[model samples]
Target chain A: MDKIKCECGHVNPEGTVLCEACGKPIEGNQHIDGNDKKTLLNMRYEGSARRSKTYTNSIVDKIWSFFSSVKVGVWLIVIALIASALGTIYPQAEYIPPEAVSRDPAVFYEATYGITGKIYYQLGLHELYGSWWYMILLALIGVSLVICSLDRYIPLRRALKIQKPKRHETFIKRQRFFSETEHVTTDEIHSVKEKLQQQRYKITEENGHILAEKGRFSRWGPYVNHIGLIIILIAALLRQTPLLFLDEYVWVREGEQTVIPGTDGEYYIENKKFIFETYSEEDGEIYKEALEKQEAMVPKNYQTNAVIYKKKGETVAGADPELEVVKEAEIRMNEPAKIGNGFTLYQAGYQLNEFHTMSFKVHRTDDQNEKALGTFTVDMNNPKHEYELDNGLTVKIDQYYPEYELDDGEPRSISKFPRNPAFVFLIYPPNETKPEVSFVGIGKNIDPTNENEYKLGIVDFDMRHVSGLTVRKDYTLPIFILGALIFMIGVIQGMYWQHRRIWIHPKGNGVLLAAHTNKNWHALKQNIEKAIANTSIKIVEDQQELDKDVSKRGGES
Target chain B: MSLEQRKANKAHKMKKRFIFRSIILILMLAAIVYALVANFNKDKSIYRAGDQAPDFKLEQINANNELESIQLSELKGKGVMLNFWATYCKPCEAEMPFMEKLYPEYKEKGIEIVAVNLDVNTLVVDRFIDKYDLTFPILPDHKEQVMDLYKVGKLPSTFFIDENGVIVDKVDGALTLENLEKQFQKILPKK
Candidate 1:
């Protein structure tokens, strides 16, 4: 094989290790660890562990090194940064369709990163706070943080526990500050020690050599704080689970009791009052807009007949309402009545409702048809008695709308609580195929709307208010809270007081002092320099007079 | 070694540690920006409020008397009103006659109205159309592709496309002829 001259341009031989002419290393066989004759495509795969081969270190050892290595920590920080950037691409806790949530290859990339809005939807990227993936990422980060912290924690504890006074002479001499003096005795140093003690420094004297370690043991606090953060993150994630569901919305609606999807009892909320209290942001004004601005008073709570029924085994359907399970009672919105191990209700919101004049059919339109299509105004709160109707139709109030409005040609109500009452009727008979629904406005002409010859009119109208209540059952809250509290404590302890070590040695006539800290070294240095000002030393002088000196140096130029 | 010198050197190193903590805090804030929205791709679906619509053919309910199929491409010189409505939706009933007045006035400006009915029975639709005295295209969307393709979740939707079949704007609820004329002005070129 022919060999060309390399710049520093010196050539020796084909398999030469070094260039004999210029005494420079040859660019020949030494760097040719593999064949140069073979192309990259034809190169045989080593199939060896590349990381291990490159590192020549155990992965565990590497992980340990990485945990302590600022470089690896920086890389982890970079990963966190990149991950955060990815987070900005979409929100977390987005509306994820269940089918796309699985790790299907065709959808995984799209679902995970949300290339085609899937990232926005299925991945819950929009609602990042409560998303499964974000929580998982947080969990992974927490685990790594825990593992990394634990890995450093043990060694740091052990290392910080004991002090080796026998440091290298060169290291002690190489310290940034030192002083040379002869006449001072060890007795004169007692005053300095007293002063340091006054500053709340912990002084530990080991062997004949005096080793005073202050703020020494506190260095391990940051590690403890890390463990706390992991716990806190876990607690945060736990709070978002289905077991700890937090459904926050205004009122569910009055008289229309929901079964409390995640809880035990079916809370029957009654809208007793929907009072909107407002205050003025500007100088105590008493206007409606000002009041709304000052205090965003929403429907506070639900006051209703809360009947708790046992899990089916306790009573028959026909059994008396008194025999039903009396688990607990609650008014909702901060007024909870506890009866057993199970519930708690909070008033998240209320529906602003009004009374309605129901129009239901009392009699059948046809004699053959058994259907009694009628317009009756029966109170929604009490459907049992006191029915009223305008004409032949016996009306029963079914659903009431308070704040009613008309959209398109149909009547629609904004408020379900009957703030402005309207009736939805079941008209039976003569025209049973399609029941007539006419919104007879309060005191409006209904004669024109009775186009159907078999007129069904409102007989009775009752307006009773109702409220919607929310009930909750979450057993894991206390545990999750406990985790958070513990985490906070750990974090405070670990993050504040860092472990700082200083080595002091007598070098001939000069004393050599070298220091190292687990965290906040710059502050530690500044503090050391400040403390050094008290001591009569030139080399270890404080930073107080440097600004003037720098000004002087600049002024000369 | 001098007794005074050893104490002073240890003090200086402690000051440097505090500076390291501040840098870490700044990076933490910068990393947090990734969780917010950053992408800026404009949505250009023809069903959306602002996009060029494609030509389509639909049967016109010329009045209660006759039915004639109208192609949007054939009426390329004039603006087109595409209304997606259903019989069950009450809002569609209120919007019908207003469109009739609009068809005659704007038909001179090359404006044509195509009402896509999402219903089953022709007799029911025909009766409603006859009752309302509407003079516009009343085509059936029985195949359901247009509704599915347009992703119309709500009924009584209307899309105003230009003479070139480019969709200029759309509305979810019912519209009166006066408001529709204003919408036409927004999409149409100024003379």
Candidate 2:
């Protein structure tokens, strides 16, 4: 191949339209035909590193050009899809057996799932999505998209911006749709321009020539879609950061307060009440029988009346710390209650079991004589509060234990029911500054010392039902939503819009017209014929047939 | 240049572009296939040692031999030893006696030892409990809910939770008598 030397001392390959070193056209490059010149002008990076001799020969340049190719981009996408599919063959590590994660995955796989499991673990299919290779594949695709779009965008923009109405006779003659007519006056040109304008074409008029183009932005559709996709990928990677997303399950039994996890215990959600309802047969005959039997009760809806509170001071266990209700709403499935910041409380599920309440009897023993102080009831759901008593004695119920048991000299609750309810109490006698601590079990005194002057004993209680809820806080949700919307728009533009252009110039007192479209040539042809109707313009032969004839004539010569 | 020469030049350029693109595509495909076969596998637990222990429910046979459901959330404000074990595991069996020995002392200080047996057979679990003479609650996790929640990977895994339901420490292997004592003390509620 011969190298064309430009005036700026740059040697470009034969058929090069633009100089590789300087942003100037190669002078007297006869190898580039009129059609090739048009295409070269439409390119974004006329003198990009991919085309420069010195740059393209380097190793980094080779790598850059490799990724800039659209074929490489498609290949990367295909690989990512296959890897994702393989990941589904075996359950991802998160969904696998809990034991499988800790031990040698190969051994666990062989012990549990047999030979296929061994192969899956051996190939890293267990955690394919999070693997370094899969991440690298995604990163490569991103690089390919960026380089591909940028390499073409600049020249394409310049070509579209600097389009002129007048072109070389051969350039106009070579278009797929061409026509001419005699006696084309200024009035005829104005009429043709008006006709093009009616079709929403952006017209640019020059002396004895006119250029009309439509859907110019359509050429940018692919780049737009690529940008949207890149944004989505970046957002997905950001979501992996711990601070950007949180998914936690919390169980706040009816009237019980629990700290929402992942919030640093700064907020608490209290379930005021849990409401569960089933579709009644009266509402629909299909559910009538099930509702009567109460056997196949299909749940209509379940909700939890929840209150979110902001912690005021340090949370002290077994004491009612000061808290202010920040937000109150009913949390239901699909209808989460937005709490402080981006935190949301969802009523995920509920449990039905026997609930329990604890009652205490206060007695003052003086000189072996026992006197009744007062009786107080402690609701297990809301027990961490002080209860004022008569006779100048104050009692604070610190904790309530259902099914209380003693293990190795320690007092604890073994079950959630009222089988053996126990209450921890701090009693302040009338004249004593120090309060007496006591553990009162159902029907018995559990305190080993039995040294308190005032005795607190659990007198009575009952059992009732509870709900479960899930809390979530995701900061990347907005970014995901915006990216999806932009992607949808880009897809519509890239797939449905077509870029079309037409040129009209005077030739020997007649008008010569030519037209081209990036897609849908048949439609472009019909549009050209419609635009030039009611005029003296004559349709020429099809551009492809004309080219074939020209080639045959050249062969004969 | 003649038309034939121009056509020939165009064909040559097209062929060069196609070859360059094809080469890159082939290389990318080869690299992807190699990665699929040679990538290393590692799985980490979702819930760490210091993270708050997720709550779950299980059914256990009471003293009267009736099935009663227990929820871990109800044990909030109390130190809890959440142990996941199986009847057939020897290490689990070996640690049962030590747990039984420490159960009473910890229970007095408001610490409960909930030994969750990941056995579907209640008869086997009952017999195992009888053999060890264990007095603590032996919850039967027939569905393995607690096991999955805790991501209990070994034969005998234990999580020690403080009064605030925060997991103070997690043990993956069977705890010896001394280790049990140390963990139990750490999980005991502050007076």
lDDT of 1 by residue, A175-220 (tens): 3333343433454345445544555656655332334456654555
C-alpha root-mean-square deviation, each candidate: 19.5, 14.9
Candidate 1 local lDDT, B1-87, one digit each (tens): 354563454344223323332343343323323221111111232256556565445555545435577656676657777788765
lDDT of 1: 0.47
lDDT (Cα, tens digit) per residue for candidate 2, span A346-422: 77878665445666778864534445678777665345457878778888655555557776775555443444556
lDDT of 2 at B37: 36
Best by TM-score: 2
True contacts kept of 1: 0.00
Candidate 2 chain A, run of 10 with poorest lDDT? A548-557
